[model samples]
Target: MSWAIIQQSLPMFGKGFELTLWLSFVGIIGSIVVGLICSLVQYFRVPVFRQIASVYVEISRNTPLLIQLFFLYYAFPVLGIKFGAQLCGIIGLIFLGGSYMAEGFTGGFNGVSKSQVESGKAIGLSRWQLARYVVFPQGFSLSVPAMAANVIFLIKETSIFTVIAIPELTNTALDLIGMYYRSNEYLFVLVIAYAIILVPLSIILTLLEKRVRYGTFGN
Candidate 1:
């Protein structure tokens, strides 16, 4: 392991880390929004949207994320759409992660007791009002820990963006390896950098998951 190579590559790794975090941030937010919309539409059986959401969830869940990224980055331009590599990566993460998140949310939404629905109905609450005031809160609490796990997976998956030449951590490490001809050291450092971000997140999410399960989340 070449400490000299690793030391020299630190700055590039720092920049790469920043970009990875940015993509993760955008991906997590987008996935949650998309997932919630998909889950809600499916849960409520909203007219046309329910069917569309079903198809989207099916395709996104079944497909490989790398293929999705390729389609977004490579195929879209052939059909007259264009986006930067980072944007393509972010879009892919949202599309793929959102499908899994939708499933998580669907499970959570379903976990809400039938009695809650009946109670809302007894109070003359409209469908939207019940969802907004009661169901969504409980569903969100149940789903967030699962969604946090998805966020971690999505962040790691962003390394695939290097294929499109997005300067994420893996790309940075690869570049350093190529420049210094020391793959082992660079790869080792790369793993450490990723762990730095993901480890704490995993611990926090574990705590939150326990809180949610024990009915002490908000307190």
Candidate 2:
């Protein structure tokens, strides 16, 4: 409960939090892109790509992210293939989040009404035109809640990067605990830091969802 120690360690926590934010941002974007592409192909029933997307989602979803990170960071090194710890952590998050995102997006795509699609076809919309103009916007709108939940989960999961010494928030907290021998203080800080970041994000997503539900993207 030493305020002084906590104050001094603020810089360290800031650095770790910055890295965590960077990882989360990049991971979210990568996951969304990967998920959207995978969902789209599977939704359209594209030949080989659809199968590949299925396998990717199945394997990524079934496996523990910890094991995936271990394989990439540890096992790969043994085979003379290597990635930096941060890179491996980012890649693991992307794969894991992308799997969940794919499922969410696929559900969203299915939620679109069949008659709307038929109407698009009757209007002579090309397949790409149908998807781009009519389907993706509505599908993405439907997916927003699930997508927000997945993003929050992915941000929290960034704590696991500590296992690979990625120096995210948890790792910084651990370091402070070792230095000050006050685990409770640092743990409190960790909780506050996460709350600070996640609470606002959750609120913003909620507002966005409401806007989407009302057919307004917002001002």
Please report the candidate that would top TM-score against the real structure. Answer: 2
Over all chains combined, what TM-score does candidate 1 have?
0.92
Which lDDT tens digits does candidate 1 get at residues 1-219? Answer: 767877888898999999999998999899989998999889899999999999999999999988998999889999999999888998999999899899989988887889988999899999999998888888888787778789888888888888888999999998877887788988998999999999998998888788787774344
In angstroms, give how far residue 213 of model 1 lies from its true place.
Answer: 3.2
Regions of candidate 2 where Cα sits further than 4 Å from its true position: 217-219
lDDT, candidates in the order shown: 0.89, 0.92
Give per-residue CA lDDT, model 2, range 1-219, as digits (tens): 888878888898899989999999999999998998899889899999999999999999999889999999999999999999999999999999998999999988788889989999999999999988878888888999999999999999999999999999999999778877889889988999999899999999998889898865323
| Residue 6 error, candidate 2, Å | 1.2
Q: Distance from true position, residue 17, model 2, in Å?
A: 0.9
Q: Residue 47: error of model 2 in Å?
A: 1.0
